[model samples]
Target: MTTAFDTAARPAAVPGDTLVLAGRPLRDHAVLEETSRYAEDVWVLTPAWLRADQKTLRLDFTLVPPALVDVAKPLFLALLAQDTPPGELPLAIDSIRTYFGCARRFLWWVHGRDRTLRELDGEDLDDYHREITALRLSGGATRCNRRAVRMFWAYRNVLPDHLGQDPLRRSLWQAWARVHRRAGGENLTDRIPEQVVAPLLSWAMRWVDDFADDVLAARAERDRHRGPAARGP
Candidate 1:
């Protein structure tokens, strides 16, 4: 199930041969291809909308950089052992590949070629996030970038404990992205009106109070069951 990328693992395409994205060379396809026994297909996606009933989805060749591939070959091989369905295995593999590619692009833009992942700090991450947001890449693409960087840190066990106080960073950025887009345009309004907040708060507060009472009762019952000798008499 390993998909390690090395000279032996290279596919039909190669170092001299190029993988093209919009007519420009993106990377060597051989380096990016998953060579696992489970990898029966390769899929790429372009953010097209699909209906809920749609079962068949088409993917193109994923764009990746050779340098990033070299850096992430271990992660790539690790993904081959994941439990993706046969039909979706290719997409799953490419999704992980795309994530690393996006992270590589961000790092390249920021540090040229000198910085190590261990040396990256909160300021560097902040700058990268701001730059990516300004670029306004497709939501899926942006998410890949965020997820890949997070996973890399998670793998190294070095993820930041505090992500600062930006509301976007504190909450799910994807959900907020949807809300921001809807506010700018797109009108399908099942969203709660601002005026409904006060009543909703009142309703929720009642549940909170009831839950607090239940907790107190449970504590009292536990205390009562303790024998006098055991209850610090």
Candidate 2:
């Protein structure tokens, strides 16, 4: 199955154009440009700002039924390219992957019934939400899944096919917090063991106290050898 953007409606990508400006901080107000090149099943984010490990975000349309890919691809691309006013900042690679995973779940579910995004109504969304709630996924997972559904409504203007109604505004979502909320306001991250933390703290303190002057003197000596040009204006 070949994938391509509708260039007649959207602008074509210029060679060497970047999704986000170089050195512009992520999640800032900087607006992301639409690129026709990203109309693919897999997008490898090679921007200089991204870490090497976080470069690939695959939206493999092949994983879903062929009927859904046409609508799904453009919607996912729009979500990726969305960073203008009223839209949130362009997602990091990991976040994009997460959203794709969440959206894919809905796509597969819809495809099972031989339906498309355009045919979906509020009842369909309610059913999807109920299915997610029935899955007994973690609070974070459930929230992410629901947010993925909401994205269709949130970026409705940009998407070729989208939810006509707001999924979150539905009365079914009113009890979301009570149903899926985690207890105790506890942090979910695992704490580092004392044995590991102790050695790390000792090394950090040694570097700050014992090696601080030696490191500063070495930098000064290196700068002195290089002369005023190394010191800069």
Measured against the true structure, the TM-scores of the candidates, in listed sequence, are: 0.37, 0.60
Model 2's lDDT to the true fold? 0.64
Off by over 4 Å in 2: 1-36, 46-49, 52-56, 84-90, 178-233
- Candidate 2 lDDT tens digits, 1-233: 32232222533332334342332233223234532244444444333223324444455666766776655665656555554326445565566778878888887888777766768888888899899999999888998899888776666555666666778778898678666567778886655544567678899999999999999999999998988564555
Instruction: Name the weakest run of 10 consecutive residues (lDDT summed) in model 1.
Output: 18-27
Q: Which pairs of residues have clashing backbones in candidate 1?
A: 44-59, 44-60
Report lDDT per candidate: 0.44, 0.64
Residue-pair clashes per prediction, in order, are 2, 0
What shift in Å separates residue 67 of candidate 2 from its native position after superposition?
A: 2.2
- Which candidate has the top score in TM-score? 2
RMSD of 2: 13.0
Clashes of 1: 2
User: lDDT tens digits, residues 144-186, model 1?
Assistant: 6765555444333112221222324434554546654534475
How many steric clashes does model 2 contain? 0
Question: Candidate 1 regions off by >4 Å?
Answer: 1-70, 83-91, 110-113, 157-233
